[model samples]
Target: MPLPDPWNRDSLVWRIPLAGGAAESDDNPGVDPPEAWVRALAAVALDLRCLRYGREVNVGRLVWDLAVDSEYFVSIGWQGARGVGGFSRGEGLTVDASFGEAAVWVADTVQSELAGYDFVQWPSRGRHLLLPRLLATNPAWVDPHGGRR
Candidate 1:
């Protein structure tokens, strides 16, 4: 069978950005979602808390990027940290390294978060977030919610 979109240069397994977010259709603006290993963002699904300050960054645009490679995975948790007010700016990066990942050196927290952290280049409408790092998290730690941990 064919592999996935984020295959490493080393040619090992498969990886990709854990794409997830709100599923709003104008009726319910916000709702509490199950807390799980949601890639980079701290909050759960449909969690409007994360997109708090996104307006300041992109106003009303929804932009995203995801990258993956052998033995490592990257994610950009940009919802403006408004995703969770406890979330802060200028912290540089935040990652659950137990999963073998690292937060990139962010230039603009808002822009960086939306662009996936590695941010090699901008995606035109949005900033170029980056997820540039070789992961070291234990394989067993994956999907910690599941028996995978």
Candidate 2:
């Protein structure tokens, strides 16, 4: 049998931009989000056991990037001690957490956010192991010519 689609209708992935709006756009340019919001997001990343990475620019600004495995990542541009941030997934989902309202909303929905991340990343984590089993069980997945169908 064919493997089931990894993404389903019930998946809680956030495809739309969050409250603050699209992270990057011609109208918005690239405005740094509030420092509080970036800090909050970093805290959430830690809570979720994600890895945090950052760099300092020559101008004294800081840029932070956080990721969950190789699946999802968010980059925040910081100016001095105050900045705002945005999150994006490899699948092209983006959320702008620049405004106060957006920041508050993100904090309030932490549980759901975690669930969403887990749901999306679950299949990816198992794909390597699962694919071999699937191919072994279902020969139709293989081509007689020695390549995948």
Q: Which of the numbered candidates is closest to the native, going by highest lDDT?
A: 2
What residue pairs clash in candidate 2, if any at all? 33-83, 33-84, 34-83, 34-84, 35-83
Candidate 2's C-alpha runs over 4 A off are: 1-27, 50-107, 115-149
Which run of 10 residues does model 2 get worst, by summed lDDT? 122-131
Worst 10 residues of 1 by lDDT: 138-147
Model 2 CA lDDT for position 101: 35
Tens-digit lDDT track of model 2 for 1-105: 432222333222221122223233232234443454444554433333322112211211223332212222232222232232323322221333333433333
User: What's the number of clashes in each of the models?
Assistant: 16, 5
Q: What's the residue-level lDDT of 90 in candidate 1?
A: 24
lDDT of 1 by residue, 39-83 (tens): 333221122223232233322233222223233333333223323
- The CA lDDT at 149 in model 1 is 19
TM-score of 2: 0.24
